[model samples]
Target: MLGNAEILQAMEQLQDKLFQIAVRVLRKDRTRIQVSYEDHLRIFRLLQEGHKETAAQAMEAHLEFGKRILIH
Candidate 1:
């Protein structure tokens, strides 16, 4: 089993990746595609609830929304 430190490190790495993606999306259009705190909380809650598929779909939707903002 992974130790606590190792798990924390992995989570931090995942957070970094998500942050990078958000930054890329914001670079496209900050005014339109800004992710709200509520959105982040909802995604986190879904994951915490063990709804992995739903969480993945929510994340995908969020990213696609960002892409749409860029296209317009």
Candidate 2:
């Protein structure tokens, strides 16, 4: 598995974009941090359990949730 730094380096551009959008939303609504953290924890737990398929879906839901927050 790639280290976090290595993974970030590999997807720096998209990560940067997400950072930008996330910052905007986070600044406006701090509660988003906990909500986002919950989503992340769900995904992380799924991965840790060796559930790749479920983890992927959790990740997709997390990203879609972020997208919804940004668009509205």
Q: Give the per-residue lDDT digits (tens) of candidate 2, residues 1-72.
A: 367887677699788977898898787778889998998898899899999999999899877877777787
Point out where model 1 deviates above 4 Å.
Answer: 1-35
Best by lDDT: 2
Query: How close to the true structure is residue 2 of candidate 1, measured as C-alpha lDDT?
Result: 61
- Give one clash count per candidate, in the order shown: 0, 0
Root-mean-square deviation per candidate? 4.8, 4.6
Please give each candidate's TM-score. 0.54, 0.70
Tell me how far the alpha carbon of residue 72 in candidate 2 is from the true structure, in angstroms, after superposition: 1.2
Model 1 error, position 41 (Å): 1.0
lDDT tens digits by residue: candidate 1, 28-58: 7666443545666889999999999998988
The per-residue C-alpha lDDT of model 2 at residue 71 equals 81
